[model samples]
Target: MTTFRESLARVASRRSFLAVSGLIATAMCRPALAQDAGTPSASGWAMTDGRGNTISLPTRPERVVAFSPVAAALWELGVRPVGVFGPFRQEDGSPDPQIGEVDLDAVVSIGDWEEFDLERLIALDPDLLVGLSLPDVPNTLWYVPEDASATVEAIVPTFGVTPSDRGHLGLIEDIESLAAALAADLDAPGIVATRNEFTAAEAELRDLLAEAEGLTALVISASPDEIYVANPSWFGDLRFFLAAGLPIIEPETEERWEILSWEQAAKYQADLILVDNRGGGVPFPVLDPIGTWQSLPAVQAGQVGPWHAVAPYGRRAFSNIVRELTEIIRQTDASVVA
Candidate 1:
């Protein structure tokens, strides 16, 4: 694993963003268009963000920067960012799978999820900084360090959609709205086709769920020490499943997740167990040796599978997940112990 300072040094050495954005800043400096047409500027663009702020750019920002999932959404809509910050790089120094086909060669990382290189971000000279924002968190930039938020915002306009804010469709809609403002061709054939595909997949899942009545699911983030069960209220994807007529087992608590002892985890039996597949969680093969995890009905029944708790939240991503879950539900044995 690369250390923070080492990552910073790596980005500083590349000096890529400064060279890439020669056209972006120049567009920002261009004169505003006529008011006779009632538009701020022919190039000006604006949209209301998840944090309830209207972020406007003097010109349709050509140089955008974001994380992997966000980059995927933008790419699907025909816009590619100039930089992408993420949790880790692969052994070959590529961004992790969470980014999903983003052009790693084109974008630079500020650092890992919890850290940022302020000077390096300034070096990007980005016209806009896009990211995820949660609901009711006064701060709008997601995953950004609190100390660095203000400074980063001051340097370039920053805004993002809250993936947890609405249903799966709602989340994509927010991204679509933002993409439209950035001049994406929302009506493009490929983009429209993806949406249609999602609709069809969702309908198929709905029919499958109807036959799998009483089937239940649990989403967990597990580690060597403890288990974190997701609270449906806190995640749009989980909520989407809950709303789709599937009975998702909810954790007892107000927080987004409930921490449990391994023994306690075995107490709540579910027909399906969705393990968090993010970098920190324990893998299925590794968990199989653990006595507590193996004792669970779902685990013993081979009902465990990877859950993308943080990645692939776009239209196609959500569609794929729904279809996957539907297949799992179809094959699930609903008589499992609780």
Candidate 2:
């Protein structure tokens, strides 16, 4: 609900990278001493599907593959996927995108999480497949729903990122394990590098984001009521901003948020805001809400910023966008300007 100009005013109040590196941003440094090193096996990772079937894997898997957006984290961590899950635009056709962002062309499609082309997946001959389905989602049927229960024999070694309901963990842990599984030296230590990046950035902004700051935010679309709250779920890509201990303003009763109405925006009195731009609405149902949001308090207070075009969580989504965010936040953080 905040105006761009207004948000600019508070950026100097905040504080805000690199190889064009993906979120993994693996820096060439002394080996981090593998977190999973000398471990009997990956502790946090699983090699079975939801059906109780075990997904087989080669010890040193090189031709890796995945079947969901969540699995893309493997790619960001240096796993060149041979297959992935993406919109095929066809009910019965190949999973091809009229528009591609993350190189869906890298491999074949297993068909969206549901309607998975088992034959297609087998055709790719991937050693591992990351599968998860939100319990409430209709497509829950397709998620490794049974695990290796049905075809435990034919299943490849796969990793379940998290509990079915927790899509966020599925995305984050998948990347972490994918890197560890590959023994990828190029990005093997990336997890530490990323956490370090977040820690350094957060320390610098401690003053600006002082817990007592009590800054409120209403990150709704100016065009519609699409919410972009910094929940652990979707916004994990923006972990740096959230981990910075930046104050959040939301209703006391609510622990998470998806969208807030204009009245809700005015009521919460958020000190900051984020707006999603859908290239005029292709990505978000709402195009721009400047007409309705121009007058919100956060906008009046000048603490709003334009949300990026991609998902702001997980290494897969943030790999390419952190660079842009770095510039935006650096310009806004009051600490940086001072």
Candidate 3:
């Protein structure tokens, strides 16, 4: 029953504890051969992660284990992981929205967002572990618990890609680069087609936004008691929307999110409101009846849309999101808010 914010705070606290105890420093001392990209060196195969740590293996990794988002990105590029750890499923046993283009029945689910099964991960005999790295947390992979870090590091070479501040397009490019290194056929017909589709969708969005002036948007995630207003700079998708000329309301805070009580939900008025539609969030149906939520200008005017806040960093996934948003914007009333 732990909230997402509580889980993040726990991870940060655990990381700080590990750093002070010098476990992180000790792990870093382990020897690794350097190689640019996914090139073969005298040692074997090597690639540098987002944090600048070069991981080397005796051979190119065929059995990889990755966080769900990373696995989804690789899946779209035709690289299948042996196992995946993250929020890949909903309570009813359906695929989570964040898991894009990945066949859950085919891959091993090691764990969810809060924890991973170390024994299962070891049994997979993985040669590589891939996940995201947050800019705020150094030397730690996004979902891999800090308490299990040293053990996981000993099991396989780890690679991380930071998503924040890069924008969605930049993140997709990074994933494509990783896919190439992993021996993915970037020139494959499907891959090429998806890329083209993404480009077209981006252009369509840009064109629409060019003509649609005076429209403003607010991106948010909600719980029963509180709402988390996203800071676009920390979210790749939001940053891309902003860069594409979407007038997203910037929260008056430096942190990745501006947490507000439900009573304060109407503090920022926008023509459109994008609510996070990921699993584990309070759904629109549940919030619609709340007096404070119903009082928001966007809600009253019905200018609300779903936000895939953490879609896989793949062309196809993003293309779908962009197309959906484009349609929503096309139907939105810019005069919803004064």
TM-score of each: 0.82, 0.57, 0.87
For model 2, how does the per-residue alpha-carbon lDDT over 177-250 read when each residue is reduced to its tens digit?
54565664434476557655644544556545563344443444343433334332223333344555644443
Clashing pairs in 3: none
lDDT of 1 by residue, 1-338 (tens): 33323322332222321111100011011122221221247657665666656777777677777855777778778878888765546656755655666776777877765667777788988988877664444574655777888888888888766543345566677677777777777899999999999999889988888888678888876765567776766566666777777787888886655778777867567989987665533376556667999888898898887766655447877777788888888888987854
Worst 10 contiguous positions by lDDT, candidate 3 = 18-27
RMSD of each: 9.0, 10.7, 5.7
Global CA lDDT of candidate 2, please?
0.41
Question: Worst lDDT window (10 residues) for model 2?
Answer: 14-23
lDDT of 3: 0.75
Of 1 and 3, the candidate ranking higher by TM-score: 3
Each candidate: what lDDT? 0.66, 0.41, 0.75
Provide the lowest-lDDT 10-residue window in model 1: 18-27
Which portions of model 1 miss their true places by more than 4 Å? Answer: 1-43, 92-94, 163-165, 280-282
Residue pairs of candidate 1 with colliding backbone atoms: none
**Backbone N/Cα/C clashes per model:** 0, 40, 0
lDDT score, candidate 2, position 157: 53
